[model samples]
Target chain A: MRNLIDVTDLSVAEIDELIATAEDMIAEPDKYAQVCRGKQLATLFFEPSTRTRLSFESAMLSLGGSVLGFSEANSSSTAKGETVGDTVHTVSCYVDIVAMRHPKEGAPYAAAQYSEVPIINAGDGGHNHPTQTLTDLLTIHREKGRLDNLTVGFCGDLKFGRTVHSLVNALSRQKGINFVFISPEELKMPAYIKENTLDKNGLSYEETASLEEAMPKLDILYMTRVQKERFFNEADYIRLKDTYVLDPEKLETAKKDLCILHPLPRVNEISIAVDSDPRACYWKQVKNGKFIRMALIMKLLELQL
Target chain B: MKIDSIQDGVVLDHIKAGKSMDIYKYLHLDKLDCSVAIIKNVRSGRLGKKDIIKIDSPMEVDLDVLGYIDPDITVNIIRNGVRVEKKHLALPEKLVNVIHCKNPRCITTAESQLPAIFLLSDAQKRSYRCAYCEAEKTRRV
Candidate 1:
């Protein structure tokens, strides 16, 4: 049961394979349209995430597969105290594959533990979101034409941002991948990610408070919203909230080939003025999410979705 | 209630004074055939509140369950009115194949056939983390 729980679960070879598969899907979308024609994807989104849910459903739909399951937990049997195991046990009988999202960190893993079908972790609280990592990988592969030997800067709430954490962990496995972690001192990348993923793996990464200084040298500038609630005090929020915003002026200092990425729902972190730049690949990142997920659904079920 | 301790039995001690029932429920000792004695709300010079549960027959209890319910439990095997093997309930090396992680988003939580896997990262803190999702939760042992 090769569940997509973490980025590490997919080895370098498997990741390359997934990237290749995604490339194939991109090349020949019509050929693989009806691959999972009779299959159904059960999207058990316990959390309220319209974007991820729509992405998964759209992927299934584009692949000629049917979709079932609830968008919110309140619409499901979970409101009656139905255990995750029981919910999965029942849902597995009805669907060919399952994509689950929940606020509890390990809930999807627990569901996969008892599910008959393969489980895809859509997102698990502040924990790992392997599919999003796959999306980021595909976007990086499509945009940069490679996933190695590049300097990637991760800006804003790196500490608790699951997307940043997952992508950094994924990129750490590749060779000559130097990372620039740009953030306020309070929301720096967590110690475990620094120690376990970077240092333990012998990856070189430098931490800096200045995004503009790190901009020119970066091949990829990944922006994330510095959440207001992460501030312990109001004064700290006012001080650091606008520090990492990537406006047009910042991109002028960056390389022409440098791609700016954001795992969207941006507040002020990414200026609206930067949208016209060909370098802003965040929208492309979202579309790649659908394509990569389309590839993943097909691969997991042995279908061509 | 006076109950005779068998030649071979297990005695649980140092239970928090009023928490004997929780331990009893967690251990499921009441369902067993063994003669069990539970002394509740007992006074101790060391502990402000304490209770005791003595089982008159040898039985194997789920150590993980003990850890989950009350982490401060001490188990002593009695042989011929003498303490033989003292088993201190410690968290398991790898908490796999038990206790379903409460997180619904976890891959382990969604798979029906896979064992509920957990790894006890902190022994002192009784913090068991999910093997797949890495969600930490404290269970008393």
Candidate 2:
């Protein structure tokens, strides 16, 4: 693929290739350290993102490549009414690749149309973050040694969670994957997603309000924070924010080998007391984000392992 | 009474009732120098009531846009007062810049110069989704 705009952009074989490349990077980090030497990566983040932006920069630095570009739109020519197409055209002339994060959905996609180099969407509003999907895939493959035949339960905020949607889109294509959506009625999975991604693919899934009821049967429990920013009213956010907290009491009913994951910068969705649990692989997910990004960068740049 | 047929022009038939005005405005037919007539609420055998637009000059009309607005529309090409060709339409596989994407966070909203593109996702529901952001196109016109 020329660009990483969405999780669906990568085929099943390509995803497996990326996972294999990431595993190779983990085993022999030094061997691939200088693969991107003398190259440049431009990180054009129009929105505020600490983890994604830093991980992209770290990934490039570890590959012996340099990183450049602004962290916010106000600091760049975008403040002067420069369009994303113009910025991408100009920046692609200077950099080998671009990792862009914007508050506008499909900003990187617009940029990709004009960019000569590959465009990696770090996070585009709530549309997609394919790199994070890659990170989750690698983490899952490492934890369970397979990506198929797993009963995965997505807990909390299925309605507005872009990561959940992207991961679900990717996982639905795999064989023997069943989804158990655990969320409040107000935050149920969108109808288009259920109809297009799941139903069209003939995937089996069930929806429920109680996470505890779906816990014992889950092989993987993906937890997401109910963001206050997504709600129009503060009272509604306050009322629904604490609906699905993954505490020790809740974990008691879960499977012994259940892998728990969260795309972090989390606002108390998963309790701090559960951090020491063997199944809590979110911290490892963060580290895997960097490694998988490294693998992706190398793949996009067409560098051999 | 019978409407005068054009010698060499285009005839849009089977338009849903009360929708010819939208098609006329959407196609910018008023800006054309040639004569254009809109026949609204006309009786039809296939439809209870339909609208027809007759243009007295040959010009390229966007069939995809017409399909998006009303897929049941049929376009008849007239030459020398004879019906030369008939064109039937289905929901287009893709549309370019025909409808504005209402999603606030869509890239086309941020980049004004970029054309709004949508792909037909569901034919049964006649649904189109933005090619960039995957937001469903809510506004039909």
lDDT tens readout by residue for model 1, A197-255: 88877889999999888988999999997656444578877877787778888787899
Candidates 1 onward: DockQ, in order: 0.30, 0.80
Top DockQ: which candidate number? 2
lDDT of 2 by residue, B67-86 (tens): 88888899999998999999
* Backbone clashes, candidate 1: 39
Model 1 per-residue lDDT at A223 = 93
Question: Which candidate number has the best lDDT?
Answer: 2
Tell me the spans in candidate 2 whose CA falls farther than 4 Å from its real position.
B138-141
TM-score, chain B, each candidate:
0.80, 0.94
Local distance difference test scores for all models = 0.82, 0.91
